[model samples]
Target: MHSIATPKLTASMLALALLLAGCATSPDFGETLETRSEQASAIAGDYKKGEKLIEAGRKDVREGRKLARKGENRVNRGEDRIREGEAMMAAARAAYCRDTGYATPECR
Candidate 1:
């Protein structure tokens, strides 16, 4: 009777071990390594300058949009719209430089 119980316990332990193994996830597939490396290389990449300008320009756009939304008069609304346009121009300039390595005079 003791021997029969020993075999049953051994079989249950093996089954539990297999089940625990199944719970383990594949390594690195669980994580998102958002490397911009490939995208950076694909672009003409003056890298730091282009990225910085884009960030600044995008911030300007967001601020201008917020201002436009708050504006009650035509004058205030016009000013905000002008700001948004300028921001878009700057962002375009940055993208052009990133793609072509130079900005057009108008973009500048």
Candidate 2:
């Protein structure tokens, strides 16, 4: 009777130890799921910020191109005015030389 009792008591103790060990090592499912959800939210926020920056950059480029075209048109108009002024000066010099019967240094 003593030998039979010892074997049964030993088996019961072994089973209890295994149950405690399993509880100690088990993962907390709720905390793991929450952590993953927060990480995904952060990634989505970063993507939105990047998209906004890209759109702003595109808008800046468009405005810069418009300003450059305006500047080029202004320069062309100034050049045309300069050419007209030179032709008027030449005509005035030629008329002065023809009427005075003397060539000035500038007219020559």
Candidate 3:
């Protein structure tokens, strides 16, 4: 074999085989960085969406407070109206009893 081939050619063939075996797989360093950046961007987007939803919930709570205040005012007004009607009915009943000198139809 040494008669036909030189040592230099044997060395060159070994180097080529080694290079080809080492490079069989595609380069992954650039692809790994790109995939990590995409994951980071997605995480950032999710964080922003969560913040916006929290803001919307805060706005809804403020609106609910406003509605509760309005409801309380309406209830207070209704209570005052009921008190006035009860006082008027009592006065009318008293007047009827005084004139009849006994239990009146209104008292019954």
Of 2 and 3, the candidate ranking higher by lDDT: 3
For each candidate in turn, the TM-score is: 0.29, 0.56, 0.61
Could you give candidate 3's per-residue lDDT for residues 23-108 as a string of tens digits? 45436545454454554455556666776898999999999999999999999999999999999999988888888886667656
Q: How badly does each model clash, as a count of residue pairs?
A: 0, 0, 0
RMSD over all Cα atoms, model 1: 26.3
**Native-referenced Cα lDDT, model 1:** 0.59
Please provide, for model 1 over 1-108, each residue's C-alpha lDDT reduced to its tens digit, 9 standing for 90 to 100. Answer: 458545643333444443344334424444322222233333323444566798999999999998877774778878899999999998987898777756556545
Question: Looking at model 2, which ten-residue stretch has the lowest summed lDDT?
Answer: 8-17
| Model 2 global lDDT (CA atoms, 0 to 1) | 0.68
* C-alpha lDDT values of all predictions: 0.59, 0.68, 0.69
Ranking by TM-score: 3, 2, 1
Model 1 poorest 10 in a row by lDDT:
31-40
